[model samples]
Target: MNIFDIPAQAWAGQILIGLINGSFYAILSLGLAVIFGLLNIVNFAHGAFYMMGAMATWMLGNYLGLGYWASMLLAPLLVGLVGIVLERLFISRIYHLDHTYSMLLTYGMTLMIESLFRNAYGTSGLPYSAPVALQGGTNLGVLFMPNYRLWVVGAAVAVCLATWLLIEKTRLGAYLRAATENASMARALGINVPRMLTLTYGCGVGLAALAGVFAVPVYGANPAMGSDLLIVVFAVVAIGGMGSILGSIVTGLVLGLMEGLTKVVYPEASTTVVFVAMIIVLLVKPTGLFGESR
Candidate 1:
């Protein structure tokens, strides 16, 4: 099959879809980057929290009669609060331990959370529709672009920028960065180290939850939704570099486009292309594309 024979519309459609997916990747990986970069926690349960965000949205809409906008606002806030609670109760206790312990604890938490959700939701997956206001598509010459998807991309971009600005520009961000580098020094200077750590973790979890909230309208609410996508998000983080914010954001968008191109050129290879790229990156620069050498 000649590449030239493929319709432009097909290419455009896939790329648009890829961009939407990349937006989700960017948000989710940003959260992972923050957690790992600042708190040094593995946070395998990030995915579980993500699932909770989506499920909580569905429950809010279904059980409480909350509309899309309300659910969207409430879900992440609720999930973030839960994250703060969990950090205070469990995560803070392990901060002094090796990273492996954190990973094991979070992974165990993932299993338990997924199990409870799966048992309750029963795997059929709850359906979520785009808000009525965004239920249409716009003609974009090459292909029709769904308004909801466009909104998703726009919203994700806003979230990413806000987070970047918060961490890189603000005074509070300086304190957070200082604490990340030296908790004892930060404490000596009158910064609340423990509180800062807890807030950082909560913020990371909140980002993941926000991604999940955006995702439900597009992907629907499934108990395994987070776990399934979690693998790819992890790859995005690794490819971007574990703790590099810009790396996570840039690599995610690039890989999403790469995935789209692969799907267009060779459908069979699309799924494995990310892992293949991940392997090459790991072999070439174990520190990651944007990671600084420690």
Candidate 2:
């Protein structure tokens, strides 16, 4: 084989890994986009929601005797309800304030939530088993792939597309945008602006939680898990465009592919490649790859 040539197995494996990571990036950043774009709140506690998803899934299994499939359905809903409560009690209060205020408040919440979980569960991570149906691997031509991972990628993609459609193409989405653009005008038009904001925030956090539930099947349940990837996911949002849903999905998948390719071409640069791409994008277009100027 030529020095420049790469083996199919190695390439395919890395691509799979990258796609898996990208699936997560797309989902997480999409949530951030929805929250910021519609609600104007910079939610720094998204990672905690992610962790909560995983923790909730784990708890459902270990405590409630719920299996993976059932937990997957229930955990995100549970986390989302918690998010709604948080929104009503805390986030709503800061809605009238600047984005910095929301960011700071959510950041404080992140710290507090993390600490509480740490105290209760300790730092050790909990394992979550994949459903029996997804326990094994499939034999692809190039490499063996896990059924669960493939499911994750497909599910993430479906969720992202559905959300994008809902936001960009639906009557309800139009109302969301209208409320976002002019709350007073929307309220005059008979839209429930405040309720809309509350629901949007809850949904955004729910998206983060859904992503977290996807993770437990792979990385297990850990309080700090979300914090670990929070920065990278933020970089993803910035690179894609701060509040652009489509941008988040596209940038996440592309950057994920780049990260994987970098791991193959040069292992050391894989970690830094995303930030480097972010810096480049920021320099070239501060509005992000897809952001519209205000």
| Residue clash pairs of candidate 1 | none
Assess every candidate by TM-score.
0.98, 0.97
Residues 170-265 of candidate 2 have per-residue lDDT tens digits of 999999999989998999999998888888988898999999889998999998998999999999999998899999999988888889988888
lDDT of 1 by residue, 190-285 (tens): 999999999999999988888988999988988898889899999999998999998999888888888888888899998988899999999999
Q: How well does candidate 1 score on lDDT at residue 141?
A: 100
- How high is the lDDT of residue 237 in model 2? 94
After TM-score superposition, the amount by which residue 71's alpha carbon in candidate 1 deviates from its true location, in angstroms, is 1.7
lDDT of each: 0.91, 0.92
